[model samples]
Target: MLPAMGDNVVVSTMELEKLLSMKGGKGEASYVNNSQAQAMHAKSMLHLLKETLDRVEVEASREMPFVVVDLGCSCGINTINVVDVMIKHIMKRYEGLGLDPPEFSAFFSDLPSNDFNTLFQLLPPMPNYGVSMEECLAAKNHRSYFAAGVPGSFYRRLFPARSINVFHSAFSLHWLSQVPEAVTEKRSSAYNKGRVFIHGANEITAIAYKKQFQTDLAAFLRSRSVEMKRGGSMFLVCLGRTSLDPTDQGGAGLLFGTHFQDAWDDLVLQGLISSEKRDSFNIPVYAPSLQDFKEVVEGDGSFAIHKLEVFKGGSPLVVDQPDNASQVGKALANTCRSVSGVLVDAHIGEDLSHELFLRVEHRATCHGKDLLEQLQFYHIVASLSFVQS
Candidate 1:
């Protein structure tokens, strides 16, 4: 049964852990197929990643493996690609220093509901570092890093103190631990009636979202500070807004565009879902402004910031070709579905969830040109070193 989202009900952290996850498996609707945009975003930061790695001081020890972790590593080839790149670069850095590279141990982490089985299945038997199959097999024990899955929320501790040597998280931190309880309470000033997200919402609603993000991010940093080794490097990439105004959509306007809101309205209008239920459903996500992000990390004081900057990228949808509106709309719908399908399904059931996205696709098709114009993607990338004290 779907959890009740009554006017007085508060969405708990445990509830979110159960409900939030990408559409799993290898099917057309799976996140693995629809995450090209996320993959591209991560790829764009490779230079920064390499630079951060170069700054990372590797303490060689035969007794301890060189540990690295990718948090929020949803099921995809992208996760594997990232792990492969990090391993290869670290190995190269070791060879450049004329020292034997310690055996690598790459940990993939995410919520318990993430498609870990698929991620494991997708991993290559040996790390692909431009080596021949024969060579890879011969040096498997020596050259290839060990791979393991660690399932949990990044907002909590997942490893032993000072255990992880390096950490990377891409497009994940925007997810809040839970929807702010006040936003769901009808009596509260921050009640977010008729909205599924904070974008374009009133000031009170936006503030509620911002506070939740601050709390969740702080917890995330505190947990990582305990787990990361002294001088270890961490790289992060997450969606962000360009404007300081909490409600300003900027380029992310496309994500929470009128079309998305209209889809929910359609459901309510058709009596497919109760108005109360519609009101209660809110996506637990927040794209902080660059300043908002910087302030949180600075306040934490457990890590020294090396690089913090915002970059813009074109829409992940392939819209360069003629008659691209329909394609772009389909892509947008699929992307949204892949990311939020589980939540919608849990809230409205499978049949209505399918109906909801179909409406989203149709509406997105009609507004494709306008959406494309406003569809620029903005991300904040940061590199930090864990400070031992």
Candidate 2:
């Protein structure tokens, strides 16, 4: 039995501080550089988002602004695509109603440490793009799209009551607000040893991670419930598991973790990194099963689950050539590095970053592309609506 979470359990702020944000000046590797996998997921979620928007009751008054919020919008490229889809669909929906399309106020939100400047700078340079939000709204030609950044963690309230009409999140929400204290506590039964993450790990470690995810997600739903209008809609896309088993090693993230762990083990044998360092490090991410999601939404009672889907796919650039091991390896390596390199670097030290990824790439190559095809990447795209009384 792990020690209960309380004031005594030390939750490290330093652990959460290292999450990669697309910041720094030019030449720095932004989330944009490594977010191909994330972009693909966002693109896929567009259809679900449109479906939800179609059902949402819009006033469609030209004088009233239609507001949309992109929760956990890392950089702006993917958010821009999502917003563009929303705008296009919204315009069409209004046109279908024989009503003129209203102006838009799109809010791009993420953690405070997120690169808002980079996000704003990278905003779509469409006809309405302008010097400021005011200018963007003042445009006469094209759609009157106004975008701005709201920097905060979405696990808490960022907007006021009944403020937003549509909320969209992609490739986020798997991250807990903080690493579970049980995993970090030396004396706890849930003390995660040997492994950096829960990939079919011991029961205690898995429970600790799941509890954290549930608490964070419940908070997420509650906060959004307050901010969203009575009949507003949300489309969320996140990493999920097909099976209820937390120990399932079939998912791509877990499989990659296994390979990454092998590389770490090799490095440990070479005396390049201490086993203690590797054991202490864990990624604060949890891929909830569909059942887990249904439980939360049902319990919340604030949102009705309209549509839920789970499917498997891979990077579009990596075609289904199971014989091409090297090509597949490179594609997978690039995708992992982009998403997780920064987090790994922060934990294991940046000096070994290049060597570590090289080992990962080499390992992937050895594993062969056929292994990639067998690896299932479970993605959950959900459409939910506020349960109006």
How high is each candidate's TM-score? 0.93, 0.86
Candidate 2 lDDT over 131-193, as tens digits, reads 443354344443347778887789888998988889988878877788788886778899877
Off by over 4 Å in 1: 1-8, 127-143, 319-322
| Global lDDT of model 2 | 0.72
Q: Model 2 has how many clashing residue pairs?
A: 1
* Number of the top-ranking candidate, with lDDT as the measure: 1
List per-prediction Cα lDDT, in the order shown: 0.83, 0.72
In model 1, pairs of residues that clash are: none
